[model samples]
Target: MRDTSTSEIENLIALMAKLPGLGPRSARRAVLHLIRKRALLLTPLADSITEVAATARECLNCGNIGTNDICPICEDNERANGELCVVEDVSDLWAMERAGVFKGRYHVLGGTLSALDAVGPDDLRIPRLLDRVPAEAVTEVILALNATIDGQTTAHYIADQLSGQVRLTSLAQGVPIGGELDYLDEGTISAALRARKEI
Candidate 1:
């Protein structure tokens, strides 16, 4: 019969290699360390992973990842401040939260409208956003999308659609050109949010 232990180790390494920022070599080292610490680390890590996998879900209202259909932020009535921050991804929303500057609600677009990739408005939750503005009594929409070409294009399109219905604003020039909100530090994000201007 084939040796099962080596095959299991290989499988573990392969799975670990698929994680972001981890390659085959790092995966190998990680697997080895986990094996060495089976009781202290591996068992606990596996249990935590299983629990999170079983409970994790996307928020239906804002697209935030959490342990329930609606994330805590979305369910919290205190966050409904008549303002919504439009972001390109959940990571950007998290970054804004980390900065703790914006107390309003959020809308995650999932991605920008990209002509090269053929991504369109219908593909990025734009219609859902439009529906939410009136439904939620949103008075202002702050475009916190990345500064990429597609990001700018998506922002302009949203602004045009919502013009005269509500106030539209975008992060100021302090956000470096082409800088994704996920990459910026909390302080920089706070500064950008504070300096936001009319789009």
Candidate 2:
């Protein structure tokens, strides 16, 4: 292997390995692939990354990441459906978008409140969420938090804060569509049963 201190490609591989869900081996393979496909992939990917690095900024309204201060979703007038989905992170918001079912706006809390990590309401975008409720004319605030202890705690706190203000709801927990019942955890099974709807 070439000395990393002297290799520009090695430096790129090192930085790539630091990204989430990537390791040294995967980074090495990816870097090799990019180098081999420089015209088709590498140059374009590099240009795109540089562009995003220069222009990406958080949406002032709902905390969604976009090049503009207000993201395209927030700028759309047709999406003003009085339904607001509150999520923990931009990734979760993106996941919801990929599903293509929801037609309303979203609020990204940035992160959940965690006692172990010393995160509080002030640390997250809780206050901003409250401010958005009235400003956006939100009729429903759906807490689509992860099914973790910290996630649940944050949900309960937000529920309390917005109890009487607007209709409060949460994302339904259940088994995945193709998941085997026998392989499901007890908590998941219980939630699935409770969330059952009439056919």
Best by lDDT: 2
Each candidate's lDDT (Cα)?
Answer: 0.91, 0.94
Clash-forming residue pairs, model 1: none
Provide the TM-score for each candidate, comma-separated.
0.85, 0.94
lDDT (tens digit, per residue) of candidate 2 on 1-199:
5575568988898999999999999999999999999999999999999999999999999999999999999999999899999999999999999999999999999999998899999999999999989988999999999999999999999999999999998987899989999999999999999989999
What tens digits encode model 1's per-residue C-alpha lDDT throughout 30-136? Answer: 99999899999999999999999999987889888889988888898999999899999999999999989899999999999989999989998899899999999
| Deviation (Å) of 196 in candidate 1 | 13
- Candidate 1 versus the native: TM-score? 0.85
lDDT of 2 at 162: 93
| Cα error, candidate 1, residue 110 (Å) | 0.5
Q: Measure candidate 2: CA RMSD.
A: 2.0
Candidate 2 minimal-lDDT segment of 10 residues: 1-10
lDDT of 2: 0.94
